[model samples]
Target: MGKGGSSKDTYNIAHQKGTPGAGGNRGDRLIKEMIHDPYKTRSKLPEPTVCPECQALFQQGRWAWAEVPPNANQELCPACQRIRDRAPAGFLMLSGAFFQEHREEIINLIRNKEKSEKAQHPLKRIMDIEEQEGETVVTFTEIHLPRGVGEALNRAYEGELDYQYTDETSILRVRWHR
Candidate 1:
């Protein structure tokens, strides 16, 4: 809350005496911006550049695969930038007894899924994968990739898949377990 009138103070002056009116549904009053994905590149990126890291071509208003033009503008794509910054926007949590037993297979599947998506959409990328003591977490540069991974795992392994989009931060979290 801000300093002056920002407090969440409620007043009931209308219903001071007698009968109460019907309660109307408060729709947007308390709703926060529920964002599934937030992009960091707000400013216009450098034009028609080639990302040496991913070998992706940034041309014709978006990323694509093209032969490096003569003196092609070279710059890092958003995905590579996210990886370099280590600031992931998507999170996938893989855990459960079943996950422990099939760690390698599941991890391979996730990697393959990411690879396929990355081929089509250069912005979709896996930032990091961490194997913790009991759980494995996969971080992504884009929201759709993690959800895609969770969906792929669910399709392949018939696991329990849960997804949530945060209201404030707009971060996407996905949990897959058997």
Candidate 2:
């Protein structure tokens, strides 16, 4: 009933003509098939070079490059990859008098602990130690805390601790109070 073609015409073309190699085994069907064979030889296509982390392919058509290749590092893209790769997986947020009093001690303890533990697990890294106004924030990545790390922290410093978990990562947010 439409201007292009009727339903009956489509049905007739779909079935009546008996398309070449139709009514064949479904298991052996080609993944990508064209109306006519485009390739002269029957061979698998070559795989494109892809980033192992993000699985992004390097295509000549899509991207323009002038000798200096971009995103040479596997960690992240040139601009954002460094920040994301270096960003801490976990953070400790502290505010008020507690931060001012125990900032150095807390940082030293965490750094020492991290250094000792990193020998066993090299993937664990400390990203940053920052103090802003009355707040102190420590950021770390790939840190695996023991069972008593939380309880000991609470006992030593008066603060609230928050934690978040995702499929691939976990974030710890700690708030210290006087």
Candidate 3:
């Protein structure tokens, strides 16, 4: 009726029974269902963002998570890494004469102090003990100490003590000055 073929031919071509486009609408509907109900599929599980060191997820704050290589030397976390990296070369610079004379006494004092303090302060731990140049440097894990411990230690040895405290860690640099 329109041009070459009759009205039925034109209608059949336009309607296109069993044509490929007939399934296009069904495909689109399937996609919409998949988008709306993603959980229906097994592959749609959520992934987690977690720390490689502590396996703790990063919630909120000023913190960093380093991406460590697989099978590499995985030792310290970012905080410990920074502390160890920035550690002074001669941590316990002690003079030969002073160290030789008072090495045992100093070590004993440190051990005793650690034992006594640890009873009250669970967070406190000795990191390192060394004698370099003319000083004995004892490093400790950062902790909130009562005022008495510092004073008592200073009085017991008649030595000077210095400490630095951060939110997560503490560094105590103790030196005996002669």
Best by lDDT: 1
Total clashes for model 2: 0
Clashes per candidate (backbone, < 3 Å): 0, 0, 11
Model 3 over residues 20-94: C-alpha lDDT tens digits?
345453212333222221111233212233334443222233123334334432333332433355442112222
Q: Candidate 3: TM-score? A: 0.37
True-structure RMSD, every candidate: 8.3, 16.6, 22.7
- Ten-residue stretch with the least lDDT total in model 2: 36-45
lDDT of 2 by residue, 1-178 (tens): 8885998876555554334334542333456533321111133222333334433333442211223335432322221232365655456665656656776776676677767655544334466777766577666554344212334466777476555544243345555455
lDDT of 1 by residue, 103-133 (tens): 9999999999988987788888888889866
Full-model lDDT for every candidate? 0.80, 0.48, 0.42
**Considering only N, C-alpha and C atoms within 3 Å, which residue pairs clash in candidate 2?**
none
Off by over 4 Å in 1: 1-39
Better candidate by lDDT, 2 or 3: 2
Candidate with better TM-score, 1 vs 2: 1
